[model samples]
Target chain A: MPSLKNIAADLPPVQKTRRVFDGSFMVLLVLTLAGGVAVGVVSGWARVGQILIETFEFIAMLAPKIGAGIFIAATLPILLPRERVGRLIGRESGVRGLVVAAACGAALPGGPMMTFPLAAGLGVAGADLGAMVAFISGWSLLGLNRTLIWEFSFLPSDLVWTRYLLSLPMPVLLGLAARAVMQRRLA
Target chain B: MNILIGTVLIGSGAIWLWWQLPNDAWRSASYRASLDTFLFTAPRVIVALLGAGFFAELLPEDEVRQLLGAEAGIAGILLAIALGPLTPGGAFVSFAIGAAALKAGASPVAAIAYVTSWSLFSTTKIFAYELSFMGRQATLTRILVSLPVPFVIAAMASLTG
Candidate 1:
């Protein structure tokens, strides 16, 4: 297996510049408009306007938090750097490896486009299935960026905290579970 | 109150990261990147928030309560988990719907399960990205191992609550 640094270094830094108006945006636009129209038809235009006002007010409330979240998400990659994180996870093994992998997954910023590729590369970088599973699970369950920026913004804080705290140990447990199953197959 | 707490927490975090920028070049790059992200994110948030609001208004409280309320029990959580992967769009869509469901009387446990399920198994993330990047075997293995997560989390949350 290729070394983690070698594998990560081989992959070019993926600068995925998201289009402001993409397929997802178009879908959201249509859904929002359709929902608004339905509300108007079902209740009244007044209710639709009310919803619009409420949305904007919520946006205003969220602006500061969103601003902070964006800064953290953007700056995190620069601070941590890919090669260092890869090296850290790649060099370790057993539970320590899984812990490092989970930590990296949670701290690493970006969406699925960035994460999945990195995960695939880690697998090639000599990381085991346990580490790989832990990494993905951590990103999915405890990604700080998603939780702080999106989850907190949309969901109630109590619910967010409850879910987050509950999920804290899951990645490692899942990693161990994956390892056990794979080992059984080998045995 | 929640927003205030979140703002303070994230605000301090941002400030700390800014302090860690190390030099002028990095600061500029961070600013440019943040601006780009803001441009990318703002419109989506606005639209998704609107959709969420409208959908919240449209959700029949009676049905939501019947389907996913505290009274709905384990079946409600199962339904929530099932709805997660089927929901189209991104993080905001699932979160918005989850919030809407909560307003319409869905149990907190069900909401947690829905969000957890969506985070782990979003079809767009899976079929579009994970399957292509991680290949079928890795993806399938990950899915199989993770199949019980939402249910498990929901049960844990219920127990704690």
Candidate 2:
């Protein structure tokens, strides 16, 4: 029989698909148009007129957010220097970096959607797996947005505080667990 | 003109409330916290809407529900967590879907898990941008780490329920 490495190498190459016109994109477009039409029909022509006006207002509100996202996306790679991020939060071959990785990850912004790309880029630039895990877990578990929203609403003060307090330990735990898994995988 | 006038009136009332509030009270804390939350989430909401527009064409609700329905059990929960990275809508849309799933007799834990996962992850986003910036290892690591979080959160929620 052929060697394991030779066998692995003999596997067929996977085909890479084009990025555009994926199933999800088509679905999103249909939903938006359908939603627009539904809104227009439900509200009537007069309401449609108002909606048209409101749409412009909504677009105006959206402009800044889009700009901010672009800015954040652009700046994150630079803001958290790759070497420092790696050293501080890198998922190295060792275990100590795991805890550090988790703490640093939780403090970063933009949630998994935004951070995933950033983390991947950082990894390319020499960041470690530990840091990336910390970052992902941190973004998911921590909620700067929810904390702010809950504080503002009519919700009970203690309830919101309790949730935040409870959530605080999760990022650390997740980071540690990930590190343990990684160590085992490596070993 | 009426809309403009109403906007101005609302703005002024908001200002009046700000002016009237004591600087350090619980009410002030609540208002500040809410404002901060709005500021934080507002951008994500925009991203979600754009993502919704992009993803609306891909997965239908029926398919989503079918995949993660009550009949699926832990498999459904795992599928929901895995698929979380694919969803693009904000909490409003996610919550609406979760409510519908609950009504359809999906386990409360599973529905909550789906919502939490959807809120936290998106595969389209990962492939489109994250991988480019964070690199494959980091991107993959993050995705792997996030995979189980929703289940844990959902489990906790279920326990209370």
Candidate 3:
């Protein structure tokens, strides 16, 4: 009888395929462009000119923050080393790791567009699944940016605090749940 | 003196022309509503930027990546999920981080889980903008609705990954 190792070794390598732009995305893009053209034509050249000016004004208003975000994103990879990140948050073998993982997850910035690429790069550099999950989890729920803005704007302090308090434990719960699901599948 | 005068004349003429443009009467209501939304949301954007800067300064990315990459067993998976919100950058940025974690040996399931949670269940944005703009009921409903999406998506992705 063949050994388990031998049987495993004999299995065919999984073929991976690159994700392509799906029909929905293409359709959406086409529709958007068509709409823009229709609006411009219907509105006339003067209106189109006004629209462009308005668009520029909007861009100008957002330029500073957007520019800073871009700069920070560019520098993130260099600032954080892969090995150190792995060592600190990747060892998810027990309860301690789980707690640390949750904390780490709540700390990262931006949304998936920025975090996903960075996480992938880290994976390429040799990060683990647990750490990746923690990082992703942390990025979603914890927002120092949102907190300060709401606080300054005269929104309810209680609401902000309650949300923060409630969110603190969610990542850990989600992580554990995900683990159970994954394990069940593996089994 | 001549150049300064020319510049002033041009600037004022440009402003006058812009102000004189015919406005869309039909779309005005919707446009105004969108403008109101923008005005209401502007402060949140400012706060988000400041928070992003603070995150960049405080928690080093290298440290974060390492934690997610090493010895990720069941516990690690749970930890990663929990940390989804705190991770820096946005959805696109987090995706990159997810990719990096995967390259470093993170499981595909955990990575997908992290991405889903990161995008859909942000605590910081909820407290600051979602709750305030839409009110507690709307915010709570969104959070409740969004909470499960990542797990469902991640579980499915895990099977394929």
Candidate 4:
């Protein structure tokens, strides 16, 4: 078993207040509110109420998984610190780097909020552009948690499997392509 | 059934991670971080889901069927790919919309194309997160290299199914 990297204990505790209502959240809120109003106008206020009620019921059903996901997202970063992951990934080149980068991206359980920062940090830690692209692509296409928690819930099992299998090679292929493009520019 | 399986797997993983925390201080800090994340994520999930539900209700089923059904073929796949980047919000929003579209008689190929396209090129993800973090040059490179993925996946999927 990998020793739980206890390095988080050594760092000074952060006291930053994370705002719940940022520009992204506001965008989503406005879109939802607008959609709700449209439903009221086109269908009826009763339909809007029913939709709201149903959405809440769906949320209730999803709460446990969401809680678990949030925990993994928060704790994983601490346990597997960015510097360590960057060191592990940054030194590699060619296919090996792409594979490692993709593996990290797929295995890491978090949303974009966590991933983009990690990718940026990886770059600063000496990862090449190709590896970074692979990392982001891997997370976008094959993130285990998102597939398990959300995709399986929404899409049919066969469809999900097909997509997953097809996507298994994408990150590496994209990484190679990114490298090729970068080389072409230099040439 | 899917939800149950997912919840159990993720729940166990969460427990294992919690057990791995070294001591009381680390555990407490982890707890605080998780709570903060939950606070940030929950509202977005709620709003995104609500928007998905409302938008699903508004979908013109007849037009969807005409455009994306089995007979619609390559054109439908192209249309689905085109619509992917335009979708706003998070993963759930795209998945929910995909589900609703499938219910409305869209073909499986179109749905796969749509989901794949959105995953790679969603404007929301690009504009809000990727650009700010990854820088414009890297972001453009990723997007450029990934531009053909959905089409390739869709093509292969159609061949098999």
Candidate 5:
């Protein structure tokens, strides 16, 4: 129900081609290739083949969730814009603000590239340090997309559940701590 | 079981969010963004997952057990935390490595610490994204406040198990 504010039209257009094949991406590719080669050399080509085959299988299994995650990440901002986000969690929003910010962070999908900008935008729109901290902490600790799609896939169900449950309260606590720290500084 | 639940929940969320778009223009924008995100994310996921698989095979299982096994205690948690920020690549890379360590006899507490620390302070994310967007002071504040989280989470996790 929030609309975007401070849309920076002067911001340069994203270079789509460069984005997909940047230096980091190249490094990642090289590392994977090198790792595969080293493993093949040390463990045998058969093991490398098996691993590559398994990797494709895992990719196939993951395709649907990844698709869903992409959709949410794209569509979410439309529903919850900076103005609405800032209004609800502005600097003086207190405990309720922290809770809302944390929940938004947990529910908001995407990686750091997506999150950090949103946090900056929200800050300009009026979110305070506490809310900002809560939002980032929530995303880092309990992002639904990351936890459900990736974490569950790799870790055991019980361990994932244990960690997830214990972490549920952390973002708000951190937000509160950040607020208190800021207050002390001001006082 | 976890996969099924996750797929169902996320699927529903995506569908509902899709239906909520206000108009044709909004729908078009959303689609465009989704496509771009897919372009950016897919390759990274594929390459990172593959890298994780290869690295999993190479990990020294005996050494891991000696360092992070149940008997390793608090030291293992600290070591795991230290490794989290230093790891390169995406979330899957860290999670996959954590899983590999778990399979190689790493304690659950240690794994918890590793994942949490990575989530909070992955050096790559901090340097490449956070510092650039949020600026130095805010980033530093967030980091300082978050310093204790992984340790506390690991401690709580250890208590129940």
Candidate 6:
């Protein structure tokens, strides 16, 4: 199993001041301002007012779901420690390991800031590239938290389901493919 | 309707998990973590949602449809896949853009392609996190292996319909 606590401890310190207003947030702000100003200029002030009102209304509706998503992201790590998760996915091999890792990835909630670090820890935890790929791909394709709070809220339910079902088998397949490629290189 | 159901399901699951924590210390630690996460996440979420709103309005729907709508066919799907990585911001931005495009007449298959591609190849995540953590080769390997996924998913989605 991986000594994940050590790996996590080794990660570069995240500056609190830089957390929210960093490059990603700057990009978001710049784009939003550009879009808002563009719409105001081209579509008129009245249209801008209407869009802002609609945005607020939508936010009100989404508050509960958003709150729940936040809680899940917070509580999941405390409930399921990285060491335990590492022990589970680590030292395990083959198709079963990939499946387990994929499931863990899907179940784990958080953004890339959290997910990537945890994944890096999985390296020390004994997970091979296949398991690691399975984990990352699973989160990418089927993150429960994102799908619940974001995807279903935005897309039509049927469209979401169709895409979801279609994508469901993918992480495992990618894991298998990664394994094949690695094995080929080794041979 | 979907939002309500999802909220309830996720909320209850979270509560249940909290209830299952071994003791008061763990519960307190979890709560502390939640607060910290809320501090870190809430601003991002609010800003992202607002940004998504502005973007939805600014998107030239008619133009987007011309580029990625039903009549646009395979080419539209390909274009959407291409655009996924180019999109700036987080998941909300992409999903909001996807929703706007759908409303603006983009195909469902195209939306799937867009979301899948964004998940895999978003340059922000790639450069900032993956490359730094996983190194260049592993990152490239994942990208190379994952490259066909969105296109294949879009094709399969179309077939299923």
Candidate 5 segments whose C-alpha is farther than 4 A from its true place: A1-18
**lDDT tens digits by residue: candidate 1, A67-121:** 8888887777656655566667778899989998998899777778668877887
Q: How accurate is candidate 6 locally (lDDT)?
A: 0.83
* Model 5 C-alpha lDDT per residue in residues B1-161, reported as the tens digit of each score: 77778888889999988777666667777788788888888899989998999988998999999899998988888999999999888888899999989999999989989999999999999999999998987888889889999999999999998
Ranking by TM-score: 4, 6, 5, 1, 2, 3
Model 1, C-alpha of A49: deviation from truth (Å): 1.2
For model 6, residues B41-138, the per-residue Cα lDDT tens digits are: 77776677777777777778788889999889999999999999998777888899899889888888899999999998999889889899888877
Candidate 1 per-residue lDDT over residues B84-155, each given as its tens digit:
998877787888899999988999999999999998899978987899998887788888889998999999
Which sections of candidate 1 miss by over 4 Å?
Answer: A1-16, A184-187
Rank all candidate structures by their lDDT, best first, as comma-separated numbers: 4, 5, 1, 6, 2, 3
Provide the clashing-pair count of each candidate structure.
Answer: 0, 20, 106, 0, 0, 1
Q: TM-score winner among the candidates?
A: 4
* C-alpha root-mean-square deviation, candidate 5: 3.6
Model 2 chain B is weakest, by summed lDDT over 10 consecutive residues, at B50-59
The local distance difference test score of model 1 is 0.84
TM-scores for all candidates? Answer: 0.91, 0.50, 0.39, 0.95, 0.91, 0.93
Tens-digit lDDT string for candidate 4 (A1-187): 2355545557525534488988877888898889999999999999999999998998899889989998998888777777778888898887999999999899898778778988999877888889999999999999998998899888998899899999999999999999999999899
- Superposition TM-score, candidate 4 onto the true structure: 0.95
**Tens digits of per-residue lDDT for model 3, B83-123:** 67765433323443454455555555566567556656555
Write one digit per residue (lDDT tens) for candidate 6, span A1-187.
Answer: 3232332223222222225467787777777778788889988989878888888898889988888787788877765667678778987899999999898888899888878877878879999888888999999999999898899999998888988898898889999998888898899
Worst 10 residues of 5 chain B by lDDT: B19-28
Docking quality tier of model 2: incorrect
Give the clashing residue pairs of candidate 6, or none: A2-A125
DockQ winner between 2 and 3, please give it: 2
Clash count, predicted structure 6: 1
lDDT of 6 at A187: 100
